[model samples]
Target: MKFAPSWDPTTAIAQQRRDAMLVRLRELRALEQRAVDRSAEARPVFDKRGQLLPRERVGLLLDPGEPFLPLCTLAGYQQDTREAASSIPGGGMVAGIGFVRGTRCMVVASDSGIDAGAIQPMGLEKILRLQEIALENRLPFVHLVESAGANLMRYRVEGFVQGGALFRNLARLSAAGIPVITVQHGSGTAGGAYMPGLSDIVIMVRGRSRAFLAGPPLLKAATGEVATEEELGGAEMHTAVSGLGEYLAEDDRHALGIAREVVASLGWQQERAKLESDPDKDVLLTLMPANLREPVDLREVMVRLVDGGELLEFKPAYGAATVCAQGRIAGHAVGFIGNNGPIDVAGANKATHFIQWMCQLGHAIVYLQNTTGYIVGRDSEQAGMIKHGSKMIQAVTNATVPQLTIQCGASFGAGNYGMCGRAYAPRFLFSWPSARTAVMGGEQAARTMQIVNEAALARKGQRPDPVQAKLQFDQIVEVFESQADAFHTSGLLLDDGVIDPRQTRAVLAFCLDTIAEAQTRQLRPLQFGVARM
Candidate 1:
């Protein structure tokens, strides 16, 4: 049956919710800009040194007019400082996927304006995630290097140990045939030297580029030697004697131009044209209710997303709550699994079967999450909820095709794991402004804890004070409610991003196209990464 729209966007409630969502989006955009502005604040210093800012370099490197999707813009928000007001986002780096000479690539630039681009713990994690994405998608990796390396004063032993994975991934990317290009615009010292050392290609700025295992002071301390910065590891020396850098440029802009030329020369081209839906055909389709509490018919959403608004429902009646269907999004065959409610034994079984069948068909799966959790009750326990839910999770974990997720509503308890949450590492995960994620609803969590507290008091033969009990319950609710807000969790790097609900189809289409392109591209893998010598 063709789905019809019942949503009334003109309603007062709808307008109010939209206003709230817009506020959140504005806040998000403002936080993102904080990093840019913070970096841009060093504009004068950069001007004095005759160099472009990090953002400027990124803009110059990317093809004009093409979309640049910034990633992890809030990775270290409220993490680097004690006070939330003072903490800056982006972890001292700017990263995104954008077109470099018409070839989509992952671009990372050091926000040296902030603390000399010292690598924060979250910044390291963000880089690793970017490398993973580039490797997975067979996209070229372009890193604009300039860092003072890890901040020694604030460093931890665990972070130091985990830092090895960063260089290891560089090797892996090269071995997988994906290019690792480095533009050494400023500094690369100590452990940071490996950045340019492992790259498939390195572009170094003549006077400013620096890549040395030990600077003058460290060298003097370790070995009674005297050497100038230029003699030690300057771009001129590296490009001439050490053979570390491949391309030599006069300045940052020149280096960026060379990087663009390098990408243009790669002969990389999209394997197929994007499949865009006809606007005229899709005009009649409407969005589902923005109020997450309202009962959302998954069909209503699917119609707006799929091409021609057609879907092939699977086991529609058996596991009615778990909706599994086959549809095409922007011409790519996709399997979609969405929940109408908690997963029961029947729902788990139905979803597992659907997942396996989709894998067999070589179709990518998109999870539309909206669930409380597996149904919990005496009858559900007897019906083997745990064992059946495990099956569904197993299928999600080991699925052969790419998995993408969008948190449409409540994503609580084991429901998140089963729905390919961030922990599960979906290729991409996005959330709507109305989405809420937690172990359970605030009220339910508070009540469960209240019961537990009461039981403990009974064991001690002490009656609970009414006022104290209410206070504890309210506290639990506040904690859960605050963390579960989409904006708060997004600041913590919980999802790729929080997106506007109206743009869901466009975002999904972009992601699907990225995956499809990766499917058709070929790489030339080597036993080891390209060697500097």
Candidate 2:
């Protein structure tokens, strides 16, 4: 009670400071509310087809519980202007370092909220910065482009210097050893398409997206030829005809999911070995029919050979002749190739494209041989089968990735070699005991021998007996036993060995493990270049 008589001036100052802080907190809350209101106003622009914003796309691609490091957040010059500040990021692009499926990657997503996601001078700088980071860290790069090409206003403002710089950066990224993936979600026209073209893999969504060197309006005005948007640049047209994209996903979500999966498959620096449990032996025996003419589904054998729930088949409906898929055996990624016997020209083209893409992506290829030969006749020739077939062969032969050949049945003629025949130089060449490998089958062999027998009988002035011809055929079959025995090829070490059908998975797993250990010591040349779409 006696101390209350002296009041310090410092106590009064402390009370004033507390009151100031309370006032500031209230003002800050009001500011936050205003920002929320502005965002709500902008939501309709992004909701047009329910598309995600650039930031949201980045969030979806990254692994859960991981944070991203935004690259050059203030790179947009337009954002510095009052008119664009409310919509665009500092730059037209938003780039950062992020993780996908626990693997580090560099991501660059365009802001559709700003000028329809156009590329500006600052946007190009943002992309270059991210590319440089990717090169430095040896990480994969992903591009989510939904743009209207270069920003004319920015280019005019910069006096044409911006264009050269952006193209140069694109070229540099294309040459970088790290994998680059690009997805086209909206209107990717003219220069917009170039960005995705510079990437190693391009994915596009159906209906909701379009990509072209020029917009339809521009084309009609320039060439005096009118075409609809779909006719000019639909997913099907680009994927099948232009060959711009590696995959055509069903929608935006599917495209992003595929992008994540593709990146995960390619993140490793070295080939990985697969470990798989033994599949049922009887499954193989019963999978294919004994009748040579009967059509059997190739997917049955592919599913059996690869680990369950790990197969990702590419262009399933488009490529009926070849089956290309990525699968895991014991948590290791492996590429699988199987023949969809007797397919049309379209199937051949699709299969070739898949093989080429797989080789470029650097996956260990496993060939499941079961094809007669390339499609023949006038129709096939007209369809450019020769050109497409040659492309497939070149891709296979030039592939530096480890290859394993498993001949299930009917590896006849050139088709056998094309599908990892012993001549193509595979790490291991194996055959099932029942596999019939020859220039032709037994029936064809008999016909040729019968002709020879008849010619001899005619020369000797004796009637050629059907029974005698049969005896001669039997004798020839006995003599050719050395060529037919699976052990002979393995014993000579020309082929690896004859593996039991059930033991295929186990054997492959062991081989993959063995090869992976050896491959880790060497650095494979990263020579793939991004194709201009």
Candidate 3:
């Protein structure tokens, strides 16, 4: 495809904005990292208890020197603004997909280091999505589970209802022949008992792992029974008597080692060819924009990603903002949908057709999101924006082939959903540090609100107060801008992770390879999940 450069990256305005974007990116990263470090506040307690930090457990569980994609690192962000300075993130859990002994698996751990690994509503959302990914991708499920069950004080009935899905998914994984391996680090009780109960292989840390339907106090309250921790459901009792745990280790390190060994023993078939590195590194470096707010020719971005930077543009003249192309990343054939601006009538229709065609061809589609939202105003509605956008949304919702999304820039309003944001369940959705997402841009949203307020006052036959309106608008604008930032949205686990732009190609290649392997592998399904023995 012939390429004419759009925005010049070397321009004074672009360079200045690029530097500012980098600064914001760094700020966001630091903020998220600060939350992670907050878990260290309990590090001394963990050490005293002879346990590793949650992330340290994850590190030891995964194979060394391999990539681990951390999903939903931020959960419960800003939910407690009263403690904004020390608000806990990560939903009291740490989870991601990583390789364990050559097997790509979903590894999740209760971050009991912080707040006893209590279940937060947002953490529940994260785990539910994690389960969907594992099931869809055929990844083996590995959980380092030891949760505080639920916090009744901050609990919602909705969270309680939804939390059942995590348990249901464990059974589903086992029945689907996707092995469920878990290490009960500590306090797997009450609602948490089912974690080990459903796993194909269970590893327990002796003297620490406590898997019980009820603790002693609860048992006494319910049945007037008195029991010690060991009598109730300790690791030794479960492994030796209850037949719940398959392996028992002396300590946290030992348990993780055993879990790794279990993964190594599973002879999962791998048919994926290694992704060959592209020679277009220099081209990708030169073409991709550093400043996300600056309009970018997505063609340049696409060219830098595809194999040898070659692609066949699909209907280039129609829906210019919604770019559709067929190309290969690391020799894997895929379609790409990206945006340079907003999705309009033409853009939505283009996406629908492109998605369907790719589905027919059994090709994966990678979405590079960069749009304010669907077009609005009189002309857009006249052009059937809603109908076409609905059709596009439907196609994205049901496309049979695996979908991946990258939030490279603006992902706002329905545009986020249409572009396969986290809510759309892309096989793997990641974001660049440059990405920003919201219902709408700050100024646009503020103006819309301001207009609505003026109209309301007019309907009441009251004179509109311009000064009061401006104040309200400005406050809303500030709030929107603060939360709409890429880092901010990402800190709430809006995407998988805020990734480096330079690593885009490699990340996409790895994900593509992972999905391809999953598609090729066969499973041995059973009517029921594997029973503990």
lDDT of each: 0.85, 0.64, 0.83
lDDT of 3 by residue, 1-533 (tens): 54443545666665665565566557656766876788888888999999998889999998798777777766666665525566666777888878898888988888887768878877887788788889988999999987888887887888788889989998999999999999999987788999898889999999999989999989999999999989899999999999999999999999999998899899873544665666654343343355446677788788778877678888889999889998898888999999978899998999999999999999999999988889988999998999999999999999999999998878889999999988888888887766778898888889988788878988999876778888888999989888876656765767777776667888898888889878787999999978865
- Model 1: colliding residue pairs: none
The candidate that achieves the highest TM-score relative to the unseen native structure: 1
Error of 2 at 237 (Å): 1.2
Better-scoring candidate (lDDT), 1 or 2: 1
Compared with the true structure, what per-residue lDDT tens digits does model 1 show for residues 5-34? 455656776566557666666877787888
Each candidate structure's TM-score, on Cα atoms with residue i matched to residue i, is 0.94, 0.45, 0.91
**Which residue pairs clash in candidate 2?**
76-90, 76-91
- Candidate 2: C-alpha RMSD to true structure equals 30.0
lDDT of each residue in 359-432, candidate 2, tens digit only: 68777788887777677789888988778777677767877677888876667766766677877877666775
How displaced is residue 72 in candidate 1, in Å?
1.4
Cα error of candidate 2 at position 315, Å = 65
Off by over 4 Å in 1: 271-292
Off by over 4 Å in 3: 2-11, 82-84, 269-293
Worst-scoring 10-residue span by lDDT in model 2: 1-10
